[model samples]
Target: MLVLIGGAAGTIAFDLFGRAISPILGFASLNPIGLARGFLGTLGLPNSGAYGHLMHLLFVGLLAYPIGWLFVARPVFSRVLVGLHWAFASAAYGVGLWVFAIGGIAWFAGNPAFLGFAPIAWVALVAHVLYSVVTAATINYIERLQHAR
Candidate 1:
């Protein structure tokens, strides 16, 4: 599914970008997946290593699934309108994820990588935007394929 693909891709992309600036920025690893892992830890799951990261990816992909479903797909040939809708919806959704993850989850989990008043915030903003756009595009592509079939 597009959600699974997009979420995984987004995580990799976000990690890559984060790694690039982290050394110069002296920032901690912006482990978005760890947000979910931390919650599981609090619940006595004690996830670690690849398992924890996989859980995080699955969590992200699952959450993204319904979002992609909600957008659905516009009529075929309405490329511009569909693009506009995807853009708007994805942007809003991305921002919501950023806020929820950074402002809510990270805050509660005591992870310092995603808080405000820092350069990482800016990087995260861009990363999230990229994520949403990719999610939208992937879902749209799948929908178009389904329609063609």
Candidate 2:
């Protein structure tokens, strides 16, 4: 749920920070919605906008769930065992997300040449990191609560 909320925030931020002002800022466009629309086909919709947004949300949840489970939530107590801070681990996971997902797969799968030259790529990377942070925090909270019960 937190991951979804963060994704919504990221989507809004992306549009607000996107190509509308690219003329003033040489690289300001990451169109996940556009990418979804192109990749997923029309889905019987007029322009595929709504379908794309839904798929984008699902993708966000799918991406964050495992990271939250495997990295942050799972290792929170283990960090204490190793004398490390949980936040440090979570942050590392966030950056790892950027390095692997946006920088690697999305770049290669989408337009490597264009992504390398775009500021939106960086913004999208941050968005993914933010999403991961929220997922980590939320899952940690839930785990704590479950234990408290």
Candidate 3:
């Protein structure tokens, strides 16, 4: 149960940080509502933006929790999981930064609407790293607890 909760928390933290950063980086329109609406439309659920958000959140929770539990149950696999986690996290951060830089450059190069929010982007990047680190630590701790039992 604790592992499940931790995974859910991690997923929420990750998505929250991503949402915050995307707007500030200018990669996404600042309107979350419109974004949600469009996302829902893509899934054939045209008037269910709220439901779409909920489903996305649920998907994250489901993916993370089982992965977390698996890591906890198999200590030998924990190291591999941690390595993959870092690789995945770094790739995500790198992509986000690249997108932000491109947008900033485009905006400065005469696309007046492409302005980037560097500060917010930086904050979001930091948040994502923090989240990954914390999740890794929590998984390690959980592994230890399981082993001790």
Candidate 4:
């Protein structure tokens, strides 16, 4: 439950920052919807902007990422580096996510790998780290609240 809440909050923050703040700050805008459409193309599927939006928002943002944080990242990191602060751990996880999604997955999605190491890539790195930190912070806060009861 906490993980879901955290993940949702984190996704919202990521979307908001990428869509609203980054462009206003003169950073390249993230086009997650277009990315999703490209991913579908890689799979030889017809592009549907609506489906792309749904997949990005519902599947990736709302479900897969949070579950990944809870089941994969937290468990492995906890045992490997005991007593590590959640913020640091989450930031590391965000870097990993950036590598997997931007560095690796970009190739399959027909984009230059690592966005050719461009400024947008840096912005993406920042966005990913922001997402992860927010997610972890939200989860930790909720857990503390529950324990305080």
For each candidate, what is the lDDT? 0.61, 0.56, 0.48, 0.86
Displacement of residue 12 (Cα, Å) in model 1 is: 3.8
Give lDDT tens digits, candidate 2, residues 5-78: 44444444444544354435666556767755644553444436787777665664444444454556446646
Give the local distance difference test score of model 4. Answer: 0.86
Worst 10 residues of 1 by lDDT: 69-78
Clashing pairs in 2: none
lDDT of 1 by residue, 52-146 (tens): 66665666644543344344432221454555566776666677767766777666666664575476676667666666666666666776988
Q: State in Å the error of residue 116, model 2.
A: 0.7
Task: Compare candidates 1 and 2 on lDDT and give the better one.
Answer: 1
Question: Over 4 Å off in model 2, which ranges?
Answer: 1-30, 37-47, 62-81
Q: lDDT tens digits, residues 1-149, model 3?
A: 65565556665565666666555666532332343344456556653657645544554343543353345433443455665554354334334433543344334334332234445444444544544444555656776899999
Per-residue lDDT over 1-149 for candidate 4, one digit per residue giving the tens place of the 0 to 100 score: 77679888998888888888999999888877887788888998776998888878877777787788878998889999999988899999999888987887777898999889988888888888888889888988998999999
Cα RMSDs, all models: 4.9, 5.5, 8.3, 1.2
**Of 2 and 4, which scores higher on lDDT?**
4
Residue 108, model 3, lDDT: 39
User: RMSD of model 4, in Å?
Assistant: 1.2
Highest lDDT, which number? 4
TM-score of each: 0.68, 0.59, 0.45, 0.94
